[model samples]
Target: MAAAMESGELSEVCYPQDNTSCRAPKQPPGQAMVIYFLLSSISLITTALNLFVIFTISYFRQLHTPTNLLLLSLSVSDLLVGVFLMPVEIIYIEVCWLLGDVACTLYYVADYIITSASVANMVLISVDRYMAICKPLSYLYYITNKTVHVVVSLSWLCSMAYRLLLLHDHLRKPGRSNSCIGECVVVISKMAGIVDLVFTFVLPILVILVLYVNVFVAAMTQVRRMHSHVDAIQSLRMVKKRELKAARTLGIVVAVFLICFCPYYSPTVAGKETLVDAATAAFEIWLTHFNSCLNPIIYALFYPWFRKCIKLIVTLQIFKPGSRDAKII
Candidate 1:
């Protein structure tokens, strides 16, 4: 029995020499290999897709509208998720936290900041669509490029500050929640969890829902007006149609964001303290990151300009002179 116990300890421990080391979860070799392959593929694809989005919007002068600027900010955050967070998470699934507690804390800090910024960008997109649809006459004046730049900057700054405060305990004492070496975990108290839920998830989602409801109603009204007034000016009808289409596309993005994020925060809603670890929270973490990959695909499906940009990018035609001025829309 003693020999068997020794064998088990040797096999299960993250470090056999360190008796206090964390136990590693057991999995078949084949299964572990397959899981690693699938996760690596997702990380690579996410990085590549967001890169395409970032470049597409930035390179094309015609695509420099306020709405695309918001998308650009979102893609940047998603790109960070793909480049940094996903890879770290993939490693965390099967390996010990070798980079030490400081790195672990910093990794999560970056994760939260990027995630908060992404949510903020989504809210801004909803606002932009709301103005364009519900108050079209003043949209051009209110949602200009300069205004968008200022708002995007403020969102990022606020996200960073907010996350720093929320995770201050972890920052002050790295690895405070770890029970053993080789483990990285964070424990959020009930109070902090509730605050995070209310500020990050509940309020943003409520705002998005309310604005979209109004936007939808106003869009339907405009559609009815266009149909009823057959003598409406052709240009005016076309503009309204374009605005309605943009709202529909952006609404899909917001809906997907909600679906991906809801399960992650459901624990707080259920009156549980938020405990984050690689093993238990893996599904929620990956689901949130997966949204980054889906956004570019969504754009490719709904925006002809995105498909055209992809073609030009693949064919190397973007390098040609005056490609920026090409009629993509």
Candidate 2:
């Protein structure tokens, strides 16, 4: 990986180069192109659905809250990645990169900035949920809407700052339209990977783990106090159920990110720091696209109000203005 990187093969660890605009190997013909088109269609449809849901939720004044607002931001970022970026990437992978260097620089910065922001938003949301579930009394003090705004704004700013290191060269400028460049290298610099691991992955997971642990402890304490009057087993069961619900949702989100992203970081996981081939790059692109699609299902099932909206859209005739059954909570 290092040698290929030294040869100016792949871009840096942040992968600042636009894959769609880079000169990748000619894709083998047949089943590959067919699969790529299908995947592209699925990505586009999912992005559209996410945009629709996000806009609908935002349009309703009453549904606005910190948690949902964070989700709105994530959906917007993911949708942009899916709608504007991934289609070109899918085509590039199935054929050849046709977009020029200048276009690539624009797309690269735009894509990673948004991707980085999505990670930041998730970390903030996890921290918010942790406070809400565990430190109920302190939650309001720690997690006001103003706090959310500050954290989210800072997250984007921080991500953009990380991205700026890549833009300090000819790689980021609007150059001659058709300048044929060599293959972009794999962005290595274990240092950047480590920082990403800690801030984007480790800290948020720790917050989630600690928050859930505290909630369970608090619930058990309450259950013990009620044991003489009520069935202790029943109280324990109820507490356990809610704990599992929150844990599963947050765990799934974190786990998906780790699985999709971790292998690219080190030897212990995948035995290399670079993508194996064009196939791996294609897979990585689609896996990231799939990640964006998952939040809708997560939101609809995990949040009561979002579930209400989905139920309204599915069960009742939503087109009818007088259908009270379609009302959202």
Candidate 3:
């Protein structure tokens, strides 16, 4: 065993002098290569996909509706997750964190803020769809661009505040809970885990589900009354069609969000303390981040506008003059 350890083939310690220091996991040659490749590929794909969303919505003048603005906010968060968080996470797999405890705490801070904001954006989208479908007449007056901007700003601000409070102790005393040197870890109490699960997961999901059900009912009713008005029938029908389509598309988005987020928060929901560690963090974090990549795909599947935008973007037609003025809707 001593000979094998001396050979440097089994485990590698960060500090040779301190036998109690954390040892980096020994990854088999092939497994390490494959894992690294997969992680790098995911990071690239997530960045590209969310970037496409951000550019498409930001560039197109016609796409500057209240709904797309909320999507723009979401895409921004997803893009940051891919660009900043995923690369660090990939490096964290086999390597010990060289960054000090303060950096580690800040890293998790960024993660929580981004993740919470993404969830809040989903809630906003669901509410938007609900208002459009269920209260069509008042939708324009209530869900204006100004209001949407305010909501998005508040969502981000609240997420940051909530995360700061949740991680207050960790921020105050970095690495106070570490078991060994060179290991990055944060421990949230079971009570805090429960609170996070409720506020971040349960309440938001409830709101989304309830609002979506009402939206569905209203959409079906609108479909039935399509021929009721004779004077403004065509205009009303056109608006209703748009709203219904948006509801369906965003319903898919909500479904995807729930599927991705549930597994990540499962451990917390199980009445256990949430341990942010290398062992089980990757599966949950990557699974959640993968939803960012999937969102654009969901849009492509359901929104014709997204498909058109992709065509223009990929063909470099977006750079041509008057591309922004192109009719997308």
Q: Judged by lDDT, which candidate is best?
A: 1
Candidate 1 vs candidate 3, TM-score winner: 1
- Candidate 3 total steric clashes: 0
Q: Residue 231 lDDT in model 1?
A: 78
| Model 3 agreement with the true structure over 39-156: per-residue lDDT tens digits | 8998999899899898899999999999999999999998998999889888888898789789988998899999999999999999999888887669878889999999999999
Q: RMSD to the native, candidate 2?
A: 8.2
- List runs of model 2 lying over 4 Å from the truth: 1-29, 166-186, 219-248, 267-280, 314-329
Colliding pairs, model 1: none
Model 1: lDDT equals 0.91
What is the Cα-based lDDT of residue 179 in candidate 3?
84
User: Using alpha carbons, what is the TM-score of model 2?
Assistant: 0.72
| lDDT for residue 119 in candidate 3, whole number 0-100 | 92
Worst 10 residues of 3 by lDDT: 7-16
- Per-residue accuracy of model 1 over 1-329 as CA lDDT, tens digit each: 99999898787878889978998866589998998999999999989999999999999999999999999999999999999999998888988888889998998899999999999999999999999989887997788999999999999999999999999999999999889988988888889999999999999999999999999899888878788777756678888788778888988998999899998898898899887878889999899999998988899899888999999989999889999988887
- For each candidate in turn, the TM-score is 0.96, 0.72, 0.94
Model 2 per-residue lDDT tens digits across residues 1-329: 88877556553222336453444455456767787778777777778768867865666556565666777777887788778767766665544433545665666567667767877776766666666555656876777667777777888888888766644443544443333342322342345446655665576667656765665576567556657656546765565455446545765765676566554444323333332223446566566667777777666667676666666666655566754433454
Model 3 C-alpha RMSD to native: 1.9
Minimum summed lDDT over a 10-residue window in model 2 is located at: 268-277
RMSD of each predicted structure: 1.7, 8.2, 1.9
C-alpha lDDT values of all predictions:
0.91, 0.61, 0.88
